[model samples]
Target: MTNGFCSDDFAPVKEAFDRNFKELGEVGASVCLTVDGDTKVDLWGGIADPKTGDLWEEDTASIVFSCTKAATALCAHILIDRGALDPAQRVAHYWPEFAKNGKENTTVQMMLNHESAVPAFRDPVRPGGFLDWDYMVARIEDEDAWWEPGTRNGYHMVNFGWTVGELVRRVSGRSLGQFFADEVAGPTGADFWIGVPDNFAKPLAPILPYAAKPGDELSEFSATLLAEPQSLQALSFLNHGGWNMNDPAAHRAEIGGAGGIANARGQVAWYTALATNDGRLVSPEYLATMTRVSVATSRDATLLVPSRFASGFMKSMDNRAHRQGNQASAIIGDSAFGHVGAGGSIGFADPECGLAFSYTMNQMGQGILLNERGQSLIDAAYKVLGFANNRSGAWCR
Candidate 1:
């Protein structure tokens, strides 16, 4: 633990750790803790690469996938708290063309709640589209909802960061990356970034093995729209394997459904402000609203998952997030809320413990949620805090 903060009893998680580590070919990972705003368990492990024999030391970074949306949402909330944006307002209010179709009624609330149904691009992502904010939003505006807006839920998957980011840019006069950097990350001094800049590119861990080679009977997006389904073909129109190091757009340049990147310390720092009254990047009231489940029983049509989503953050038990229980339930606190990446990476805060936890791995895992190893560390944190099951109702009391 750093500076006398109590280290969590994390060793118990070492056994299945290999299974988790091997899946993603994870090179490095770190976990940071803040109890009542104190640092603890600032731990790191793994390697920078298998060939170079470099140890996964402190300061390594990895792409965090969907977790970045929480940070992006936080940035939007800052504007809301200051009276610049309204979750209740329609998207067309900010970008008039967004009213092109039935979306004329889509609200910021629907956007955050993932109920507006513009989950993927109506048109495929093409060269220059990643950098062209106008092109993306126009598709969102004209795109027909896979399911009627607000009638049900669907994980926006890749579209959320960009949709919300575009909303942010239209309202704040800055791209989501620029606004997040200048205000949220910059002010909090958090290491997280939506689009990683070139200067920090040197430390990025390569996506291990990348997407696993597809199965011969690939359950590719079905040929016809099944129940509430958009042709799975839309995904190709979205990211289409654009997250590689050779990709020129810089991972942050386009907020993929799965591409926010950061280390553990920054993750902890970002949430500590809200949980422990530390005030790093957001106002306490904004944090409260963001954390509270705004739509409790919503089920996502896009992902065909049940979800409990707030404006932008996700509730752990909901199917709405494709990566639910695997990561969300492994952590502590019913009041706890945050996002996890495609692999074992987790970044969440438990207000009752005054705790914030973030973990990222360079390796990738197809598992929808936290693996046994990641869960073990989560269990350890709870054990250290004096809760055996951690899920027992007593801790919050």
Candidate 2:
């Protein structure tokens, strides 16, 4: 059921990918890894649509959830590199209306680091409000801060799109989707899209929700969602304006926080550029700054897990020992920085090893972070790279 090219040096990754289907319950998925700007592994298999029994193809793309945040953050960094945006500057400097609701002191870096405290809507979200960019931006403008800005960090959940994305739009004079397409994807030849076009012709795979088994345990975040209906954790994920993720209109909307659509190849291609510093994305010096840890909290307000972030990207977060059974962790190299989707999808660039890696899947996984199916593939890739262990939370050579 699996098909793709794999160099002999990286055959273990192929083994893990195939094992995911045979033993780990992977429905439809693709994984790509590149080292030194060269493709080393590209694999895809299983059913794209279980209902239709359509097999996944090489070009099949699906919504990657929060992985889209990395792309949106990249757009902001591009503007920063061009001197059109400043992280230390007040967000109101770019978007004046954002100064309302005690947010005048919030800086761009605060928003990027999830410390702006406007994590989610406390009031009921209007039906289909997420599909409208202006409505969401206005919601952010009027919403009160959950805590003092820049004091504590919380996972922005869905609002990262408008919070950070608005700065990109105002400074770049282009929408986040348009800026990424023209500046990043188009030049890099990546097949990813923020707002999928109406004429998009690629084989699109609809995400299949995770089916809970009899003995499945819940994480702190999951437990909160069920126990507290009106909590920030609940509002951030459940107050989504009743928009169906499978709807074509949802796919067409530029929900930069979670609406990205791409396959493994497309994600790896984009990361490869960032990893190799090919002079197309950002300068090497700036890229180094972008990948370093910007903020870390022992307990995230929304996710309810230990988390670390670099600007808008996620740094290596290992919660394996934080919780007993249902804990989830993403253990990449110390130099790696990227984002993980709601399910298990992930894309990252490890500049230390000159590596770019991505895993895309149709079947949603249970945990808030990388699940076993995705973590196994990452572990195998690191082993092939001669990493000794991840016992220290992150893979080390």
Worst 10 residues of 1 by lDDT: 216-225
Report the number of the highest-TM-score candidate. Answer: 2
lDDT by candidate, in order shown:
0.65, 0.92
Please give each candidate's TM-score: 0.83, 0.99
Alpha-carbon error at 153 in model 2, in Å? 0.4
Global Cα lDDT for candidate 2? 0.92
TM-score between candidate 1 and the true structure = 0.83
- Model 1 per-residue lDDT tens digits across residues 1-397: 1111234454433322444456634456666777787776676677756667666667767777778878777777878888889989988788787775567678888888878777766555665565555666667777776666777766777678777877888889988878988987776688887777776643666556436456522212222233223354346234433445324465646573555767888777778776775555666656678678887553345543355766887656522134333432334467777776655677887776787777666666554445555666666666667765643421333
